[model samples]
Target: MSTNHEELTRLARTLNPQIIDEFRANRGKMKNFPGPEFLLLHTHGARSNQPRTTPLRYIKEGDTYILIAANGGAPRNPDWYYNILAHPNDVTIEVETEQLNVRATVAPPAERDRLFAEVVRQAPDFAKAQKGTSRTMPIVLLECVTEKD
Candidate 1:
């Protein structure tokens, strides 16, 4: 379904705490929530410079994790998306109770389309969301920022 800014903001405020709690309590598994798996993404705010942690559905591709900036199909991108764009160097991720530094990058255009299609194929709700909005959702890759990175 198409989402508005207010609706998305409200939903985030309401659901994130619970999701984060459950993800942590269960060691990164959110039981019945949508998608295959999840991670807690910590990013510095684009404007405020404050840190924000958001629970998000993800698909793991080897060492990288893929995220969709769907914002429940909102017209605008999620705050986390802009945050990562602004401070790509200052992001971290928590998965399976393990915290690690990570860097965010927008998947290349062609790859984004392919990955988006793959994601929609796996999660039909995302496909519904895509059909609900005009904006092109971003597909982000979060790569571990190891010492050698």
Candidate 2:
């Protein structure tokens, strides 16, 4: 099915709280799903301070959340990426049950290459995404901070 951004945004705004509640209640797992569609929330821009949330394909590497700034193979990086770069200190992530205060940083070149290889092995679209754009896609690592108990 073709996903409509406007309709999805409207529904997300209207039903996010409830959907989040359900996701939390299920222990971060969406049970009644035919696939992996109902999994993540929109991540807003921090520097421009705009409400732009794209459905990101992610995977956990150790204790970090790994994301790619592929922008569907666009020549320019996504605005959210620059926002994170500008305001690396003030970043927040909303998971199914928990909201995390995070520090966003771009992975180093060597590590990014390795991680990109791993991600492409899993989700081959990333390879296509790289081929679609002239610019090199960035791999970002979001590290969660733990507060003192």
Candidate 3:
């Protein structure tokens, strides 16, 4: 609550439409980003169960995509957090030009620390976000679907 998340969320709300449009239009090559790279997280609402999508920054771990709940030190967890909690296996992501079905899981604490360290290694501003927040940002693992699944 003591970080830039409020302002960042405000900006994201104002610009998400344009960013989403450009992301789709350009096949995931965003044009006017002021921060990190983004991916589209598709999920259903926690309460309404309605479909939803949000733009997010992510890191890759082998084939899995790691989504940390850091909205540049967002004031609160995004709605997608609740959505994934309600529907963990029912998730998808739009990465660049490809649409992927994925299952979501929140990493346990130790794993979160490790994964977060890796994220900060790749995108260091996440460290700044960490410094600003009292809460531990959740690390969401979007495991890819397989034919067996």
Candidate 4:
């Protein structure tokens, strides 16, 4: 069996780019990954400092976008999670036809359950993914950043 690291690597190098390409080419809609709202999250790698773009499913709360670091219910958090922690100020996201500067923050423990439950209610697959892993999924909030340059 392939290790989780290997699987994540394969996905990062292959499927991620395909999704990203389709997302941009189609004005942010992914045909292959339908259902559940999608967003393109741009982050810098924590170790290499190289740019990384990850396609994530999100649930929006008002103007804030909520993303879960479920890693498809793998044994570990996705790489972008660490990336956000290391460079929270340098994150941005693509939604629909607009690209927006955004800040990433992990939801506090007290609030995570409520958010996670809502996600499961809308997208039941997340509940199944959660059952497959031992670690709790982290809820990440991405809020728009407006800076006058």
lDDT of 3 by residue, 17-61 (tens): 887898999888777764556899999999999998898888888
* lDDT (0 to 1) per candidate: 0.88, 0.69, 0.85, 0.88
- State residue 42's C-alpha deviation in candidate 2, in Å: 7.1
| TM-score against truth, every candidate | 0.92, 0.69, 0.87, 0.92
lDDT of 1 by residue, 27-131 (tens): 988887866688999998999999999988888778989999998887888999999999998999999879999888999989999898888877779888888
lDDT of 1 at 78: 91
Clashing pairs in 4: none
The segments of candidate 4 whose C-alpha lies over 4 angstroms from its true place after superposition are none
102 Cα displacement, candidate 1 (Å): 0.9
Q: What lDDT is reached at residue 128 by model 4?
A: 90
Reference-based lDDT, residue 114, model 2: 95
Cα lDDT tens digits for candidate 4, 12-48:
7888778888888999877776558899998999999
Q: TM-score: which candidate is best? A: 1
Ten-residue region with minimum lDDT total, candidate 2: 33-42
Q: Residue 85 in model 1: shift from native, Å?
A: 0.3
Q: What lDDT, from 0 to 1, does candidate 4 have?
A: 0.88
Supply candidate 3's per-residue lDDT for 107: 96
In candidate 3, what residue range of length 10 has the lowest lDDT sum? Answer: 1-10
